[model samples]
Target: MPGYKNPDLEYLDQQGNVVGYGEVKTVGDADQSAFNKQLAKAVKQLRVREDVEGKMDVNEIFIQVPDLVDAREVRGWFRSYQKGRLHHGSDLEKISGYHVRVYTGSGSKLADVDLGVDADGGHYDESTHTYYSSNGYSY
Candidate 1:
């Protein structure tokens, strides 16, 4: 649409269908506010677009930030935002459908940070090879 915002990256499936949308923040020192704005905009755009909303499998949203930033702090900020949004009656579908991934230098490989909201309303944050649960437990 003419007034709709565009995502930084669109992930398509083999059938040329949009499966996910991504917003990338290239500034290594960018703060959580920037990321929050980018993600909120991307989600709003994706939710309003008919083509994207029609696809049931198109639920994943990616927030790509530079690897130089602190992943732990970024995840913390995202979780906090999510909690606040959920408490304020935001759509659950949008609040819990994001993944934060970091890219190192110019490599194609993605360092995935599995930040997911579980069925029990708990947060999952994974960095590198370690995993942390929302209940102040890490293994």
Candidate 2:
């Protein structure tokens, strides 16, 4: 669908403008790198929200520290940067918003996979163990 964005949670103001939004993530604190990866996903979602809706003022990230990782070593660098699609600061501005096409080495057919939107869509290769949603579908 065109111009369609589904966010887990959305925030709006009195004028009904999209103010803030973010997705909830429950991650094990055993590894700092794993936690960082989860944080990166949230960052991208924050940009999508701002691009589709609006910007926010305050910035914050809350999470529990896993005893296995160094408490001070954990990076709290969750500053929000808006990466728009149709609006300002959108990286897709020059790409013409959904008009761009991808090509592999063959260049014969369009690529069907969009790995970026994995928070919703999930895929798994029998040869590999890249499981996104264990509850939705898994083998």
- Highest TM-score model number: 1
Q: Highest lDDT: which candidate? A: 1
Q: Estimated TM-score per prediction?
A: 0.57, 0.39
Tens-place lDDT per residue, model 1, 112-135, is 433345322344445453335553
Clashing pairs in 2: 84-90
Whole-structure CA lDDT of model 2: 0.37
lDDT of 1: 0.54
> What would the TM-score be for candidate 2 when compared with the true structure?
0.39
Worst lDDT window (10 residues) for model 2? 95-104
- Point out the worst 10-residue segment of candidate 1 by lDDT: 113-122
